[model samples]
Target: MEVDGSKGNMAESPTNSQQTVSDDDEIDYSVKPEFYDPKLDDKDELWVQKRRKGYTSDAVLSCPACFTTLCLECQRHEKYVTQYRAIFVINCKIDSDQVLKQNGPKLIKGKSRREASSVGGETLKKVSCSACSTEVGVVDEDEVYHFFNALPSES
Candidate 1:
């Protein structure tokens, strides 16, 4: 068996230089494109209306505990790494039944995006729970729509 000059048995071992070389060969995920355009624009009309009307939907849902109004908007994720969980559940309250009746609930549906600026065209309010800082709901011109109770808390 071969041994080092110090008489200790020496076995072939990976060096820091070899590890560095292997790491350099690894794929660079940061250079990959992350966003893809939505395949369909089925809600185009509703979306336009919501933006033009400033989310003036008349849909209303009240909190049984506080009687406070609520509404919702989808917020995109902050990082580009994982966009699947990008859409955030936002809340506020508004009052505009005429808009809701005219456009329908389908317009309220949100699509995830890669940009935070593009999230919530106009319907999404910036209201938060005055009590817990939790986003309670959002409102349009006529009423408020509360968030889904089953949704996990946004940390």
Candidate 2:
């Protein structure tokens, strides 16, 4: 509160009452504070003991284009390959995730691509993002979805 310049009356100033957020002031809402365990990074024997009790490792998979969480699973083998820009789950025997259910994989009728890097399948089904209909992954015969291609461009 401040005295009015002309009327001498107590009034609140705009600068004191309102706050403007700048472009630099961005907050990442993806990580939940409660679920964050700072001790996970500790490379000591105590950390191993703590994890042995009731520790669970979870990996959150999100769409590359829209950043919408596609899968939330504890499958320790699953990972997103940065070089290939794809997600690979060891063997997708588990049921589909909520995001994948909503935007299920659309099969490419009468077509399949020969994958050179996959250790499991010779050909995989190409899938698109529901939020984007853009090709983002390939699925194998075992129901494993390998997200994005890690193939480097020739040019």
Candidate 3:
């Protein structure tokens, strides 16, 4: 019987180049570092409102009537007029299920855009607390509702 040494040896031995290629193909499924921002702690309502006059993106807002926590602090964003504009508007993205619809005339006549532009008409519908029927926020044309009558959950 002829001994088949070559086949067995090749299977057992991995060349340096092959080993490096295998190592390079390894994938890391770990979560991203930026997913959790350390700076969010400093952007809460207490800090932003005291200095800037309103909530920041890191403020936990809740329904004022029932005190139900509708949205977390991380869901908020500051709308500014310009890079150095004096006007600042803080808006929070609240879920639709958390609010009750109120009867009001349509605020905008056009579709909502993902990003605000000069062409798109800004629409806003009045919304209230689902649990207490208290006026809470306005549903924008983007379908993202804001907590206009919300207070800090911690307060």
| lDDT at 34, model 1 | 60
- Candidate 3 residues 48-147, lDDT tens each? 4575445444455666767765554335435621111112223333343432322353333323333223444554555665666676666655666555
Runs in model 3 lying further than 4 Å from the true structure: 1-57, 73-120
12-85 per-residue lDDT for model 1 (tens digits): 67777766856557858677546744643656646545643554322333333454433223332345322212
| Candidate 2, pairs of clashing residues | 84-150, 86-147
What lDDT does each candidate get?
0.37, 0.44, 0.49
What is candidate 2's lDDT per residue for 51-86, written digit by digit as tens?
334533234455565655443332333354342322
Summed over model 3, clashes come to 1
Cα displacement (Å) at residue 123, model 2: 2.3
The prediction achieving the highest TM-score against the true structure is 3
Ranking by lDDT: 3, 2, 1
lDDT of 2 at 134: 51
Give the higher-TM-score candidate: 1 or 2. Answer: 2
Residue 87 lDDT in candidate 3 = 23
Which ranges in model 1 have alpha carbons more than 4 Å from their true place?
Answer: 1-6, 15-25, 28-52, 56-155
